[model samples]
Target: MKKIAYLLSVMFLFSAFAPAAMAKGVKKEKTELTAEQLVRVGEIESRVAEIKSMDFSEMSKAEKNSVKTELKEMNKEARALNNGVYLSVGAIIVILLIVILLT
Candidate 1:
C-alpha cells in the first residue's frame, strides 16, 4: 500500500510539473478600455435603450429580422469592448481554499 501511494504521488507531481516546464509564456489580452472605447460603449448602451423603447409590434417580419441581427452585432461589439476577467463560483471557492491552505 505504501509503495503504491508513493508511486502515485510521484506520478501526479511529474505530470503536473512537466506541463508547466514545457509550456511557453502566453501573451495576455488588453483588459482596460480606452477613452474612445468608453465613448463607444456608452453609445451602444443608448442605442440598445432606444431600440428597446421602439414599438416592435408595428414592424414587418423583415424589419424585425434586420433589427435582431443589428442588436446581436452590437451585443458582440459591446462584449468585446468590455473585456475583463470573470471568475465563477467554483473558481472563487477553489482560490479561497488555496489561500486558506497556503496560510
Candidate 2:
C-alpha cells in the first residue's frame, strides 16, 4: 500500500540518520597512543633512569612536573589522532549495516 511504502521510507531515513546523530553526541574517550608518542615516552623513561643512576636529586621538581605534563598532553593528542585515523564514520556505518543484516 502507499501508506506502508511511505512508512517504510520514513523508517529507513530515520534509521540512517539516527546512528550518525548518536555517534556525534557520543564522545570516544581519547586514549590511543601513536608510535611517535610511544617512542617519546620510552625516551623520557630512559632519561629518567639515566638521571636516577647519576643522581636522582639532580632533577628539580619543576622539571619533573614539566616532563609529566608533556607526557600527559602527548598521550591525549595521540588518542584524538587515533580516533581520526581509525573508527571512521563510514566504516562504522558499514559495520553497523552488516550487524543489522546479520541480526
Candidate 3:
C-alpha cells in the first residue's frame, strides 16, 4: 500500500512539473518585416526568378559568368536578410532539448 501511494504521488508530481518545464522551454514571438525589407526581398526573388527563366545556352561565356555572380550576390543578400529567424529557431530547439534532457 505504501509503495503504491508513493508511486502515485511521484507520478502526480511529475505530471504537474512536466508542463511547466516544457512551457519554460518555449517562447513564441511575432516576426515582422519592414515595408522596405519586404519590397527588397520581393525584388530579389523576382530577379532570381527572371535569371532562372533565361536561356543560358544562348549566353556567351562572359554573360554566363556575370549572371552567375549576380545570382550568388542575390542569394547572399537573401540569406543575410532571413538568417536571423533561422538562427533563433535553431537556438530555441537547442534550448528545449537541453531542458528536456535535464528534466
Candidate 4:
C-alpha cells in the first residue's frame, strides 16, 4: 500500500540519520564556546533554514563546512550557557532561602 511505502521511506530516513544526530548531540554538550561562537551558530541556523526552504541540491563544500563549523560552535556555547543558567538559578534560590531564614 502507499501508506506502507511512505512509512518505510520515513523509517529509512530516520534510521539513516539517528546515529549521526546522537553523536552530534554528545559532541555539542561537551564543548565550551564563546559569544562569537553563539553568533556563528545563529548565522548558520538561519542559513540552513534558507537552504531548506529552497530546492538547491548543490552547495559549495566551503559553504557546507562553514555552516557545520558554526553549528558545532553554537552547540558548545549553548551547553556552556545552559550550565551557567543552572548555577545562577541555584545561587539565587540559596540566597533567597538564606534571606527568608534571617527575616
Candidate 5:
C-alpha cells in the first residue's frame, strides 16, 4: 500500500509540472528594431568605440569631462534600445529555479 501511495504521489507531481515544463520550451521571439533605430544604435556603438580608442592624455580637462558625459549618454541610449529582454529572461530563470526548488 505504501508503494502504491508513493507511486500515485509521484505521478500527481509529474502531471502538475509537465505542462509548465513544456511551456518553457516555447521560444519568445525578440522584437526587431526598424532600420532607422538600428542605424542609430550602430552609430552610437561606433562613436562609443571611437571614444574608447582615443588618447585621454592629449585632451584638456573639459574635453575629457565632455567625452565622459557623451559616453554615458550613448550607453543609456543603447540600453534603452534593447528593451530589457535580457533582464526579463534572467528574472524568469530565477523565478523558475525558485519555484522548482520550493516544490
Candidate 6:
C-alpha cells in the first residue's frame, strides 16, 4: 500500500513538472541577443541611465512623477520582451522533498 501511494505521488509530481522539463535529453538553444531586441533593450537601458544621472533637484514635482511613470512603463516593456523560461523555487523545493521521501 505504501509503495503504491509512493509510486502514485511520484508519478503525479513528474506529470506536474513534465511540461517545463520536457527537453530532458535535448540540446537547448541559446536564448539571448539574436535580433533587434538587443538594440532596443540597449536603447532603453541607456535612456534609463541618462535619466538616473539627471539632477532631480532641478526638476519640478510633476516632472519627477512623469519620469517615474516613464521608467515604470519601460520596465513593463522590458519584462514583456523578456519571455525567458522561469524556474519556480517552490517547485524545486517540492521536487527535492519528493526525492528525499522516495529515498
Clashes of each: 0, 0, 0, 0, 0, 0
Model 3 scores a C-alpha lDDT of 0.79
Candidate 4 lDDT, 1-103, residue by residue in tens: 8677656656765675688788875643555667887786677678657755754357777777776786677667656555642447876775565455444
Q: What lDDT is reached at residue 61 by model 3?
A: 100
Alpha-carbon TM-score of each model against the true structure = 0.53, 0.30, 0.52, 0.31, 0.53, 0.51
The digit string of per-residue lDDT tens for model 1 on 1-103 reads 8677656656755675587676647656656788999899889889999999999999999999998999999988876777754668996785565455444
* Worst window of 10 by summed lDDT in candidate 4: 94-103
**Model 3 ranges off by over 4 Å:** 1-30, 84-103
**Which pairs clash in model 5?**
none
Could you tell me which residue pairs clash in candidate 1? none
The global C-alpha lDDT for each of the candidates, from Candidate 1 onward, is 0.77, 0.67, 0.79, 0.64, 0.80, 0.86
Q: Locate the minimum summed-lDDT window of 10 residues in model 3.
A: 94-103
Q: Model 3, clash count? A: 0
Error of 3 at 17 (Å): 27
lDDT of 2 by residue, 1-103 (tens): 8677656656776786798898897777867677887786677667656644654367788887876786677656545554654567996886676456444
> What lDDT does candidate 5 reach at residue 61?
100
Error of 2 at 47 (Å): 9.8
Q: Candidate 5 regions off by >4 Å?
A: 1-29, 85-103
Top candidate when judged by lDDT against the true structure:
6
1-103 per-residue lDDT for model 5 (tens digits): 8677656666766786699799897977898999999999889978988987999999999999999999889877888888773547876775575456445
lDDT tens string, model 6, 1-103? Answer: 9999799878988798797598677866766765799888999999999998999999999999999999999997888788666568997888788887788
What lDDT is obtained when candidate 4 is compared to the true structure? 0.64
Off by over 4 Å in 4: 1-56, 84-103
Model 1 scores a TM of: 0.53
Task: For residue 21, give model 4's deviation from the true position in Å.
Answer: 31
